[model samples]
Target: MTNDHDVVISGASLAGCTAAILLARRGVRVALLERRSDPDAYKVLCTHSITANAHPVLDELGLIPALEKAGALHNDARWYTRWGWIEPRSAPEGPELPYGYNVRRSTLDPLIRARAAETPGVDLLLGHRVTGLVREAGRAVGVHASTPQGDREIRARLVVGADGKDSAVAKFAEVPTTLHENTRFGYLAHFRNLPLQGGIGQTWFLEPDMAYAFPNDDGVTVLAVLPDKKRLPAFKEDLEGSFLEFVRALPEAPPIDSAERISKIIGTVDYPLVTREPTAPGLALIGDAALTGDPLWGVGCGWALQSAHWLAEAAATAAAGRGDLDRSLAVYARTHRRRLRGHQSVAVDFAKARPFNPGERLVFSAAARDESMARHMYMFAARLIGPLRFLNPAALAKAAAVNIRHRSAGVSPAR
Candidate 1:
């Protein structure tokens, strides 16, 4: 028997939940399936930080109030170089408006799924695992799923794969996915009362290695360190202690030693990530499933929500008779490619090599040397300005000029 709906979404994480909420609001009947039995399930290995641009979508979804209640921290980030800290300048609208935020996935994922359940046209199906996809003449028309009771067939005009980097739906659809080799690994954990300059996020760039501290809502700070894959053996031996030591070794590591750890010092060797094209045929992949970039950029959650919005807009338009499923899928692919392909390409390129270039050294050094440069770099770090936008011809020229002037004055650019 076929369980019918206008759309069927697999995976109930950030991307899945957001897509469901948006589509349901458009009066489209949606059957959102999550393999997990828990309705509040979320990704355990995520950074859970989102950019300021993503806040608009949160507002559109009416999630701001709930997020605030959940104690999400507004994260205005600072970039630390060998020179000094480049702090985010104050904006009139405050931290949330100018910078991004940090909310644990444990808090955010459930909040989003709960909102999906409240959506009028949404049918939340927990503990149902999709075993296969049902296709009609080379187009995705439905899905075959395993419910606790038994096997079931769900037929829909559109199928969305919101699963993470490893998407089962994309595999079943036989969409050719491109996978790249990652050379870095990550270690992370949360600590309480860490003197991490409470209320803001900081990232320290240590040439080939990187470390970051995010002051989350619960007065707990999440720390992550990205190191080369070759160091895995040493890292595994003392995962927790080594991670803390690595942070402390940085030029401006917070006084984490004085704090109490709330969670185990968990670590994963996969620092970088891979992704396939986000959409194909009758199925669309969002979030990590589509294009997982280096987590070092902290763009995953924001991209997930943004991609959901794009997919929802396209899906809704198609369902409302303005377009067909194929057209909708094409629109989603184009929108997604336009929004993130360049950034992802750049991130991948950098992740594969050492972390810095001479140009980066000059820019960061200038920020440490000049307060104005620090503020500008902070905006760029917050993603308010794109790579070229911040490192524009004029900005680069100014940084170069500053370097030359400082050198002539017998001041060396900070390493």
Candidate 2:
């Protein structure tokens, strides 16, 4: 059958734009659709921190130079726990250390979207919402989109749902999904004059409660709090005040009081984890559409970019008529699951709002006093390695050894 485009991707956000750019570079015609009419529109309630795991993908997309030019900060992460700070020491000599970008979505979204729009084979369709799927013999052939001008059907060899957590494409396609409950609510806002030490981001694991201060572009620092759901009434009663109090109570918290609030306090009170099957016969799901993990871990943005790269690489040959489309999509689905499922499982379990268990306490305490352990923790948290590798016997044994040495020497782990 003839097709209007090689791929029809819904939701012109991070995943959609990245997929379009990558596929277009591979000579695939992409119909990039966005429901929002405004070109500068962005997701407000986001961590806005891309993990180092996605650095290779961003570099491949040629976004690093542009992101740097746009004043995005390259940041490592520091963690605060009851045992003390877990700050990994940077390598003195060797290849340059990997780092992630800290740029507001307001800047990031528009920049990538504009790149996609300007690409040769991408048709950026603004104000186009995917209303339903166009299927033949139970395989999606395209999408029925509602445009400002009128409803239209765009036919393609593949349909992609990059529309996020509540994906309309996934809904219309009836993809299987599994939901997990989150017992924490969150709040975040940007402030000026709130700089982090060494320009690194900080995350405080206040047991079940969590807070973060990520230094962003243009001298702005985004501070956020994720409190247990039982504290919802206190936050509802006074969002700004309660937020400040909670953050200030943390050990070595940023000077939020001395900073100027540059943005309104915004948040998501109810964000449940969502996992969906990543593929169907003629369709694929990327980013949050496939798996929405706990935001407290800050993996969403990085996974979005990485997933898009994986999808483009998997489908480009088939879309260009060099291979079988179904086989290509299946490959993408398997790759996505293999790369992400472990991390998603751990994040989902932690979202249950429970305090750190014994294993966690041991690791955190040892990490505070042992630079080697700290580095391993950092790599795991940055998603450079999966949970299985992070919790391997060697790492656990080292953690135990560190704690034992400290105890024998009568040296307290915490400051």
Candidate 3:
């Protein structure tokens, strides 16, 4: 049977918009729906830092230039652990290392959404909320949505849910979901004149507690703290005070006292991990709809963009009627799992609010003392490489050698 569009994507955020733009560019007709009517609406609770793994995808979408013009900071990262700082040293002879962006969602979301709307074959439908899926012979074929004017049935060969953590489409499609518990909550606010060393983002792994200083666009720096739930009472009692105290206690912390607070502290008290199967017969889920991990690692935004690229690449041919849709979707699903499942598992394990394990201690301690180890750790943390490679036998052997050398020199591990 004929369909209204090739694909009807619910949610016009990062994943949806990226998918819409890429698919449309490949001659596929797309309906990009967003529940919010305002064009400038953005997600406030995000860490707003995109990882290096997603840089190529964003560049492919022609957003890198726009992002740079908007003053998005290209951020390198430094981590402070009990074993001291793990700083990756770039080799002057080697190719330049990849960098991620530190731009607020307030600027990022609208910029991308506008790009998608202006693309040739994408229909940006604002104020359209997906309420249910249209199923034919036990396969999803379309969606029923509540639009500004009235309820409407949008038919398509494939339906994509980029609607985020609490996905309406995933619910309607009855996808299997697994929930993981997070024992920490977080708060973040913006500041002015808060300069990090070389404008690099800093993450302090204060054992069970974590704090970050990410320099963003236009000289704005975001300060965030993810303290254990046991410290919630103090933070709830006085957010500003507790936030300041927690950040100040970090080793060689930024000069927050001299900086000006620019935004009100915003936070989520509880963010449970959500993982779902990304595809069915004629349905697919991208971004947070597929996997919502602990946000402390700042992987959400990057994964969203990357997943959109993967989905669009996989489905474009099928949507154009040149290939089987289900087969294409299966390819996308496998690719997504292979790329993100290990990272998600690590993030969930950390979200349990436990102290670092022995392997973690060895890696972090060695990284602090050895440049090679630090570079590998950086690659793993940046999501540029998978966990298996990072924890390979050779890496573990190198870590052990580094630790032995430091011990021979009588240098304290905590130093």
Candidate 4:
């Protein structure tokens, strides 16, 4: 038998769940198919940090209050370079530079699915395993899935794939993806009673070695290290001991050794940066299903929420009879391409685990000295804005001027 809705979303993670909430609020008939039956299931491997790009979506869903109540931390990030720390000059608090959010995936995932299920126009089909696409005339219509009772056929005007890196929907639709090789491995763990940062997140960039201390709720700070594959030998012998030693090696190491670890260290050895076309035919992909860039930047969750918002807006319009459904899909594809491609391209480059080039050293050195450049670096790092448009000859010249001044003062610019 055919169960029908205006749209069917597969994978009830942040992207799929957020899309369901938005569409349901707009009175669109939406079915969210989640493979996981347990309400508390989430991606354990994720850092669970989302940049400010997700603020609007969180506001629209009325989730900020709930997130705060659940002990989510608003992260103010500090970037470190060889010269010194590059801090964002305080702005009058507002959405323009809103603090990023951090919450454990175990807590956050259940919250997202529960909220979406509560909305009026949503059908939350938990424990449904998607088998294949339901297509007609070379366009996706829905998905064939399995529930505990029996096989089910779901039909919809559109099908959304919010599944992660190995997306079943993307595979079923034969959507081509571009994958870039990543040359580094990463490990992270939660530590308790770390030195308080007043809600600030710290990142130390030691050339090819990257470490972060993100102060989260529950008075615990998450520490992560991403080092080139060549540096893996020491870690292979003693993961915990080597990890602590590595942190202690960092310049002015962030007091991690004095803290007690709350969770076992988790890691990923090799993963590729992936990008895919956001939409095709009657189908669309969001979150890691569409683009899985370098996790070192912590943009995954934000992009997930943002892409869900983008898709919901387009789907909402089509559902309300304002435009052709296909046209809306094309619009999503265009906007997604325009916004994320450059960022992913840059991320893939950095994922090679190479040391900063001369140009990067100049930018880092200058940003440490110049307030305007530091603000730009902060904005770019937070993903509040992309840097390509204004990072031109003028920016370089300004950085060069800073470098010249530092040299005259007998300060080194070869960071």
Model 4, span 155-240: residue lDDT tens = 88889999998899999999999989988888999988787444578888877888888877677788899888888988898898
lDDT per residue for candidate 1 within 1-415, as digits (tens), equals 2445888999988888899999988878899999999886668776769877677789989998888888998877777766677665654455533655799988888889999998998999998899999988888888899999899989887889888787898889877777666677887888888876645788877766778888887777888888877777888887876787788887756887788888877656764466677776778888888888788888889888889999998878675445687888888899888878777766877787475777777788887766567767767655556777677888888887777877889976455
lDDT of each: 0.80, 0.92, 0.92, 0.85
Q: Write the per-residue lDDT of candidate 2 for residues 138-173, one digit (tens) a residue.
A: 999999999999999999999999999999999999
TM-score of 4: 0.95
TM-score between candidate 2 and the true structure: 0.98
Q: What is the TM-score of each candidate against the true structure?
A: 0.93, 0.98, 0.98, 0.95
Kindly report which residue pairs in candidate 4 clash with one another: none
RMSD of 1: 2.4
Candidate 3 per-residue C-alpha lDDT over 1-415 given as tens digits, one digit per residue, 9 for 90 to 100:
6876899999999999999999999999999999999999999888889999999998899999999999998878999988878888787698777888999999999999999999999999999999999999999989999988999999999899999999999999999999999999999999999988767899999879998889888888888999999999999999999999988888998998999998999998999999999999899999999999788999899999999999999999998778999999999999999999999888889998998887888889899889889989989888999988888888989999999999989876543
Error of 4 at 228 (Å): 0.2
